[model samples]
Target chain A: MFTQFFYTLKAYKVPVSLTEWLAMLQAMEKGFAGNNLLSFYYLARSLLVKSENFYDQYDLAFREFFTGLEVPEELFDELLKWLSEETLKRHRDSVDLSSLPQHDWETLKKMFEDKLKEQKERHNGGANWIGTGGTSPYGHSGVHPGGIRVGGESNNLSAVKIATARKFRQYRKDVTLDVRQMKVAMKKLRHLRRSGNLLELDIDESIDQTCRNAGEIELVYHPERKNDVKMLLLMDAGGSMLPYAQMVNRLFSAANSVNHFKKFRYYYFHNCIYDHLNAGMEYGERVSTAQLLKNLNSSYKVVIVGDASMAPYELFMENGIIDYYDRNETAGIVWLERIANHFRNVVWLNPNPPRYWQHPTVSAIANLFPMYQLSLEGLESAMVELTRKAH
Target chain B: MQNFEQYCGTGDYIASRALQNDVNVAIALGRPLLIKGEPGTGKTLLASSISEGLETDLLVWTIKSTTKAQDGLYIYDTVQRLNDARFGDHDISDIKHYIKHGKLGQAFTSPKRVVLLIDEIDKADIEFPNDLLTELDEMKFYIPETAETVSARHRPVIIITSNAEKELPDAFLRRCVFHYIQFPDAAFMNDIVKVHFPNLEEKIMKEAVEAFFSLRELDNLRKKPSTSELIDWIKVLVASGTRPKDIGRELPFLGALLKNEQDYHQVANGETDTRSIRRPSFLR
Candidate 1:
């Protein structure tokens, strides 16, 4: 009945619900797929998989279930070679276990350095010398236990190889946020208020007025309700935050695209906010912290994104900022406290997970502001916290 | 069950076999066919193509960010009624006088079956698709003001397209047939171009397609040229009387292919290594 295929898709975390499963069955019953497996593959894929993000996982599941169905004849030679090599590796593993010389950590490090100095040309498939595919402990893909895997393919089953390759790791929702999802999350920060001109007619009120007037007709008008929420996003850029640049760019683009905000502004800072914040990510124009505090009132909801990973002295001590030319009389923590005190609703979004927030600077900043992880749930909760009535 | 006509590719539009199959399946099942793809892959054009192939009238409802679900079914023009009452120029007693039919209402009350194309449903609010779920599934909607229920005379073929501005609700997606139109490969692109320009020279076509694909292969292009762009570039080449051999050495009218300033400069500066363009086998 191919029920295992449904379970296989679910096992691969494809989010295939029974509704889609039944739809695919109905499509098949309607003779859309006919009897060919190729047509059936396309039919099932178009029905069961909703998003292209899950297409790769569905492909993996399909290959896992329908093994050797459409594999080319040319691959049989490679398959035979791989099978023989696997058997040879198994045979070598049983005999070579006793031959591997035991060396302690320091001795191994010293021996690797000595081998690097002694060896000159590239070495492959030998018992001694640092090279690839041999009994050597330092080289790659050989029979030695705890051998270092260098720049060579792993000799394993094709399924394991494909799974470990993880070609679609970036498409996984848990790994990063796309612009659309972030825009949806940002949309929850709306606070509607009737502030515009009274252009729309109040029909019910006009009807009530006319009914009360007995014979005369009257008209009523009301202002349109518009989103009045103002937001200020301060993001950490460059330095230790370089690894998360793409993710932060997605967030930035999402925030930029949500045009419903009354006023949306963003600025960039390094590890911590000090005397000034950069107007752009390239640090072209500078906006002083004092100037920012004077211009923007406490009504603006502030969301600061950063890793909060830095030297303790850089945050706690004066004249300890990492930028050599820019000196500050006030410490980074003091500036953070000033902003936190000025803003009624403020939240810190750490790209690093909560487990890594044990650093001294992170805890110090977390105590100053309610810190939340930069994720979908975290963003929703942070927006909830920002919209809550402040005493 | 009603007899539904099959949709083959029209003379203008060249659809892939899988797309043609999905379209036929959707028509037979009487479900909305949701098409998603990159910007210029002709997700919107497929609806018109289906209409043309099936020989039915096409009703397009272009959605915007401010579009509401109720606007598609019926709009109770209360303001017009109030104005009529104030001016004493028109009838205001009957509430149905001001009730106007939207695109969906028009499709439902049409004399003949039509193709309902909800273009770019994701441009509207995230809940927009979910709001139309009942109307789309049951092919009927109720108007509380007029105390009337409007159902389809004959079930209209529904087609929806999305740029993926927002993730559609699962309930809305569940009721529809989904298909993702992949960007065509080189051979497929050649067929598509020939459909547009049947009289194009063989040598010019070969050189143009080769240049267009290699330009797309360059890294860090913010917006890669698509099918529409390629067709425009080919039109420009044919009109300008540019030589086929000159296309490999100096790509004239590069603006039609690359729209981004960064992408334009990248190609113009010869940063990409020009792969050797071989003559087509037929030419030799």
Candidate 2:
């Protein structure tokens, strides 16, 4: 189930990981964790995501993977608004609202007021006007006049005035709409307020929207117990390893993404360790296996998966990379030995078949690690292995 | 590599068990193992990961066209012998004592066992595997002038990989184990994608991954994108500041992931104008 959610995110380019899945699972297990969510949101932020953010991502995962449910539309729309706002902030820094024409600005503000009114109406279940039974998507955006002394009786005039001013200020020439277009655009904007773009969904927006659709959970905020698990991944990157490299990278990224929510460390290694597989120079990305392992606390799990069979000496030489950077430095197998000692809960998943260990190179390398050669055909074996250790 | 717990794999067309068993057995026997597969099937990562999983030193000696058996092992200072000969009073035994440690010699002599990876052995001449006969079998080498045998304090784990461009000799192959690495199935590939590129959005992950998988066919392409390339694509997506929902520009970057220029051209041409392939309605 978690894998499905992970996959869904991967498919959409959301980049979910096993560690984050675990956290989401934990959050679900605990029912509703407001604090865990806060942490989860912060964690997702580090993924370099800003639109709907981690809250939205986690919400989508929660609905789809855990409860086997989907979030509601209203909440989803709120998140979508955030997504649009963030997207605009990211790409339209050059489009300053102060530079727009006065009339266009007024029209835009009026459009915004209409949108706010529409959202409030939907939130109020077609307009009771007082506090709605459920939480509003724009909880404190100052658009909705909650019963608590809003300093105005009948917010219609103020809403229109403020929204019109805001819209006018934010108006851009390149993003112009003619008078007739504005009428259509206003209707569309209202529609967006009520229902997001069904045709072209921002996946991140959709995820955020879907999450908002989940409404509010009975959230409890607190710190989670630190898990004694660190995941180290070794991926085959270039050459024959390249085809599956994306998969491996995604898997690693999934684990990394999931780990972002949790507090586990990870390491990356390339083909068979013969000479020292320098974790530092891998993918031109800076990470040192030596530094990670040395500093990493024990009580963690290490997993290695790859095809496992290469040239005969790939197992015996230094610098395991097929194409050496500068020198013919072969990665030594000693590197694996070093990593194995630091973490004991190690398992190897072969992207190859179990029968194929017949190859001397595969066998030779498999000899050193706790490996499970999984058939690439299904998830059963992988599922079994991943949980069997605990069972 | 064995002892993997955190490795998430990618793809949906994995090989059969017959190939994997060969790899496990070879690792157990400490024999020189040779792996074969098409490009992008993850041939090299297996060798490196095994060494990493074992926590052993991995020495990858990538075979070149000029690579020889001696290149697989250690290349002693025969040149230093001539250098020493520059002096009139060079002793034969003393010159032999100056034997420099080649990759193989270092492996055979080290206190700690090393993982020696002879990557792309097929790229070298046929003589490459023939040279491993003595050192691999007995784990020992003899210096003729010194008249002494340097045996293995520890036998380095040996793994050799080839893309099957050329078949090795019977004798050389007989000494090693073999496995054919292939693209993984969708489920496993999903796990793989999750493992490495954790921060990317799932929506694009699946679509782009499927796109990558589709490229496995179409003979016009030269090389297939590997597990590494997928991670890179994800990175590109993330770094390009694209939303999890937006990956329209991602097709052009496929050139980075696609191995064949023709395949890339095909994808580039078909995708650039088609707008639908580049930006599906569901995603946009």
* TM-score of every candidate: 0.75, 0.38
**Taking chain A of candidate 1, what TM-score results?**
0.62
Among the numbered candidates, top lDDT falls to 1
True-structure lDDT of candidate 2: 0.49
- lDDT by residue (B201-283, candidate 2, tens digit) is 77878766766665544433445677668768877877776664345444646756876677577667664422344344312
Among the numbered candidates, top TM-score falls to: 1
- DockQ: which candidate is best? 1
- After superposition, the stretches of candidate 2 with alpha carbons farther than 4 Å from their true spots are A1-391, B1-22, B87-93, B248-250, B272-284
Q: Please give the range of 10 consecutive residues that has the lowest summed lDDT in model 1 chain A.
A: A82-91
Candidate 2 C-alpha lDDT tens digits along A1-391: 2245467566545545455355444433432211122222222222222112122343443333322112335654553433222111111222222233222334534544455556443233111222222112122211221111112222222322322233222122223222322222111111002222233324454435445766322222233233233445555543556656545654554455443223444434556543333454155554455666676665455557677777766666654446566323425556666666666556676766578788887776667765664322222233334333432
lDDT of 1 by residue, A1-391 (tens): 5677899999888878898899887776656664334556667776787777676787788767643222234633433342233222323323334347766456766776677567765566666665555666554455554333343343422333444355555555565576677887777788888888997678889889988987377788999789998999999995899988977988898888888899999999989899999999986899999999999999999999999989998899998788888898999999999999998899999988999999999999999999998987688688889887789
